[model samples]
Target: MKLSEGVEAAIHCATLLAQLEEGRTMPASALAEYHGLSPSYLLKHLKTLTAARILESVSGPHGGYRLARSADAITLLDVVLAIEGPQPAFRCAEIRQRGPGALEPEVYAAPCNINAAMLRAEQAYRAELRKTRLSDVISDYLGEADPRALAFSCAFVARNQRPQG
Candidate 1:
């Protein structure tokens, strides 16, 4: 199943936020600039995270946003739900009884096997996402990324970030 664009933006944003030290924050505009995104568009997804309690929002000159909890406490599934809502990706339209040669009520009364299979796949996908924490993803990425580049990125973030107050 395909995830929404908001889901992708939210994941990357969370990963950046996950890199910050405890009690630190980055403004939405700063984050948008860092990723070469539009602040207005990115802020919409940021609000989704805030509404989901994955991140917290602050206002003022030095105000911004920070994780509500540790990175290890948040999972990809949490972000997915926050952006995509609780609807299943594969929606079954119950086509079994709508064809020219339609089946009887009893023949299609039981849950459709195709629908059940899709639901099962969705469950497995969610289970995998739940098993993965945001910190785990960051650690894995840092492990494979260029050390010098990673250092430079961290330095950039450190320079622009604000300490939580």
Candidate 2:
């Protein structure tokens, strides 16, 4: 199951927002620039997050966007759903109902093994993702990097961030 690029972008953008001080805002352009993404596209992703209430936008000279809740409170699934909607990745077209050798009405009522297997896989994927929060991802990333390097990266993002007009 392939997820959209917006899913990745939204997750990264939310993770970065989680790093900022509470009440601090970061512009969409800043987020896009930091990740080398297109600002227009990133803004579209940001709107999804906002619509999900995972992030909130503030308007004004110094206003931009900030996480609506704590990082630990947001799950990977939350970010994913925000950008990609709540639709399941695997869609069953019920191929068994069609084709030359279609089953009879009584037999066709039963669930196919393929559908069951896909359902199981999707459940497992969601379970794993639900186990991981945005906080966990950030902690894991920071744990592997040097303090100086981490600081430098943060500083670079801060320096390069363009405040919204």
lDDT scores of the candidates, listed in order: 0.89, 0.84
**Residue lDDT tens for model 2, 1-165:** 999999889888887887676567888888988889999989998988998999999888777788899999999989887787787888889888888988777887778789889999988998988989999999998999899978977896577443544
Candidate 2 versus truth, CA RMSD in Å, comes to 2.3
Error of 2 at 52 (Å): 0.3
- Compare the candidates by lDDT and give the number of the best one: 1
lDDT of 1 by residue, 47-132 (tens): 98999999999887768988888889999999999999989899999987897989788888789999999999999999999999
Write down the TM-score of every candidate. Answer: 0.94, 0.90
